[model samples]
Target: MSGGILSPLDRAIVRATQEGLPLVERPYHAVAEAVGTTPEEVMARMERLLAAGVIRRIGLVPNHYALGYGFNGMTVWDVADEDIAEAGLLVGNLDFVSHCYHRPRHLPHWPYSLFAMIHAKEKAAADALVASIAQLLGPLSRGHLVLFSSRILKKTGLRL
Candidate 1:
């Protein structure tokens, strides 16, 4: 779970994965060479990491803005405490919703606990999606959209 407990090779793999493997015909081989390991070894270690839950997933993150999805909104919902988990699952299942999670509510000032992300072609489309979610969650549920004004500052793998 922690880098300190991982083997040197595993740590190297983690670092490489975070920084991103080289873009080449044989990406694994390129990564292995950088980390002083063989392609087979890198593949094996990755498999082990996945099996052990050290790595949840390995995949690509496309640029939504480049794909014509210019509106990126972080929608936070104020669902009842007892319904947070169910509501999170429901919201996460939506095709437009990219990420959903639960966080502690900030009372008096802020009361949202569940958060979901939506990327759309325009702000109106994003607002429509939020409206649909409101209809599904009812009056107790309240949300606000935070539109991203600039590019994402950070996007990378976990350090460990």
Candidate 2:
């Protein structure tokens, strides 16, 4: 049995796939070949890593821009602290909301705590999505701001 530290092979696997899995039918096999191992071995090791919580998850990161979703809005809400959990769950389940989570509130200048990300082809569509979230939150939402993204940010998973 091994300790908590990652093995060399495990590190190799993480490094190879950290950027992203290959865009192919058999991505794991490609990763295995790159890391000098069999696909089965690579899959088994990845499973172990997931079970141990060494890696949170493995999933595709799509480019919304390429998909014609140019309007990206990060909507921040001033949700009641006690009702944040329920509010977050409700907002997060919406089809338009990509992600929703709680954040620490800064009093006075910045009172918003809950945040949800959304994307659409037009600004109006993005606003409508935000309004739906607001309607869902109801009185639990004190106020909110839909901060549209001005530029694309580098998106990457954890590094080895």
Candidate 3:
């Protein structure tokens, strides 16, 4: 693992996977070719990287909207800094929540510190998920807002 000190080859492997694994019968072989390594070595290195905690997951990222999860809302909250970790863990565990993370507040005008994205087939379902998050946070949340997305302008995850 080298204590997360990635070698040049390790960095190359990470970079190759960033754009996402290639769609092929042997994706690892493709990655190996791109990184100038053998497929077995690539798989072993990836396993080590995973055990080292440098990589959290490697899997498909589906477009839920295409699968009838049309309503997506970003629920933002102004939570006490001390309680955010606990509250965020609870919110992130909800089945409807797709993503959750902490972000810096913009102060006076924009004060949300934690954000959670919920996806559902309808607006009412998304609203119910927001309500569940509100109940979980309870007094820990000073204020919260749910902004339902009207459309998907861009779908790809940012690579740079």
State which candidate has the highest TM-score: 2
* Clashes by residue pair, model 3: none
Displacement of residue 143 (Cα, Å) in model 1 is: 5.1
lDDT of each: 0.81, 0.90, 0.87
Q: Please, what is the TM-score per model?
A: 0.82, 0.94, 0.75
Ranking by TM-score: 2, 1, 3
Taking the tens digit of each residue's C-alpha lDDT, what string does model 1 give over 51-73?
A: 88887787778788879988888
Model 3: weakest 10-residue lDDT segment is 151-160
Q: 1-160 in candidate 2: lDDT tens per residue?
A: 1687999999999899888889999999999999999999999999999889887888877788889999999999998899999999899898888888899998888999999999999988988888888899999999999888877878976687
TM-score of model number 2 = 0.94
Model 3 TM-score, all chains together: 0.75
Regions more than 4 Å wrong, model 1:
1-4, 139-150, 157-160
Better of 1 and 2 by TM-score: 2
